[model samples]
Target: AQSVTQPDIHITVSEGASLELRCNYSYGATPYLFWYVQSPGQGLQLLLKYFSGDTLVQGIKGFEAEFKRSQSSFNLRKPSVHWSDAAEYFCAVGVRRDDKIIFGKGTRLHILP
Candidate 1:
């Protein structure tokens, strides 16, 4: 079965510090990668996605992710993070055949002053 893993359950970073949330997926063929952010009481927002064409994809809220096939990773990165950016990040993988998406456990980001 296909699965996703977000190694960090929680991450704390100072204001203006760079942030990186790891995401790894296991699938036989090429799978779709997605990054989503959910605020305290808000629905999930699509941060970015990598279906094809590009290895590095840009997302909303000044976020970006790089897809590395060899590593089977689609890690999200932000050069500088803000307090407003604090939220729960989820990495998802979608298979073409079943049209189903598998989500990770989720990583909660904490911003510090």
Candidate 2:
């Protein structure tokens, strides 16, 4: 069985500050990893993924993550934050041969100007 856990349920950051969200997964084999961001009343958009090479992967909206095999972690990071970036972020694991993906409960990010 494969599963993902997001430690932080919610986070608040000031504008132009750095941000990081934690993620941990349990899988028998190397699984397809993904991070998605969803705005209120909107569908989820893929931020990034880790399927093969390069432990460090970059994604849209100036976001990046590092895949740590030993720690079973893939944490999201951004140098500076923006007010518009406020949204709910979800971490997901794609199981091989499985059409569906499992998503974390999500972390609601609040931005303060």
Candidate 3:
């Protein structure tokens, strides 16, 4: 069974703080992983993705992620998160965008003043 997992349900951090959101996946074959963010009451937007070649990929909104094949993890990281970065982040693994995109339970980020 191919699936994406996000262990954390919520995380809180102050403005201009470092952030790391964990993500894990189980797949039978080569995995195509993706990180997506969703603002309140809005559709998801792709932050980053890993298809092939590079192990570490840079994403939009100053976000990046490293793909670890040994651990099957693709954790999202931000050096200094802003208040506007507060959103629900979701991890996905699948064949393609229109195909079976298995998404993990999202992690909601809270920004403190």
Candidate 4:
């Protein structure tokens, strides 16, 4: 079974400020982890993915995430955020072999000027 947990329901950050969103997952020994962002009424956009190799992976929009196997966590980070970056973020885990995908509850981001 694959599962993800996003503890933060909402997060507020000022424009140009740094942002970090936490994610934890429970899955097989080696699971495919991904981070996605979605705007209101829009579909989810892939932010980053961790399949193998690098523990730290970079994504679009100045965002990055590090996979910590010990903590079972993959936290997203941005050095500086823009107003347009405000959106709902979700953490997901997938099994390529089974074509199964599991998503988190999601965390809505609010930009405060």
Alpha-carbon local distance difference test for all models: 0.96, 0.94, 0.94, 0.94
Candidate 1 residue lDDT tens string, 5-113? 9999999999999999999999999889999999999999999999998899999889999999999999999999999999999999998899988999999999999
TM-score of each: 0.98, 0.97, 0.95, 0.96
Measured by TM-score, how close is model 2 to the native structure?
Answer: 0.97
Return the candidate ranking by TM-score, descending.
1, 2, 4, 3
Give candidate 3's total backbone clashes: 0
Who wins the lDDT comparison? 1
Ten residues in sequence with the least summed lDDT for candidate 4: 93-102
RMSD of each: 0.6, 0.7, 1.6, 0.8
* lDDT of model 2, residue 39: 98
In the range 12-93, model 4's lDDT, one tens digit per residue, is: 9999999999999998778889999999999999999999999999999899999999999999999999999999999999
Top TM-score prediction, candidate number: 1
Candidate 4 segments exceeding 4 Å error: none
User: Which stretch of 10 consecutive residues in model 2 shows the poorest summed lDDT?
Assistant: 95-104
Ranking by lDDT: 1, 4, 3, 2
Residue pair clashes in candidate 3: none
Please, what are the lDDT tens digits per residue for candidate 3 over residues 52-107? 99999999999999999999999999999999999999999986545889999999
> Considering only N, C-alpha and C atoms within 3 Å, which residue pairs clash in candidate 4?
none
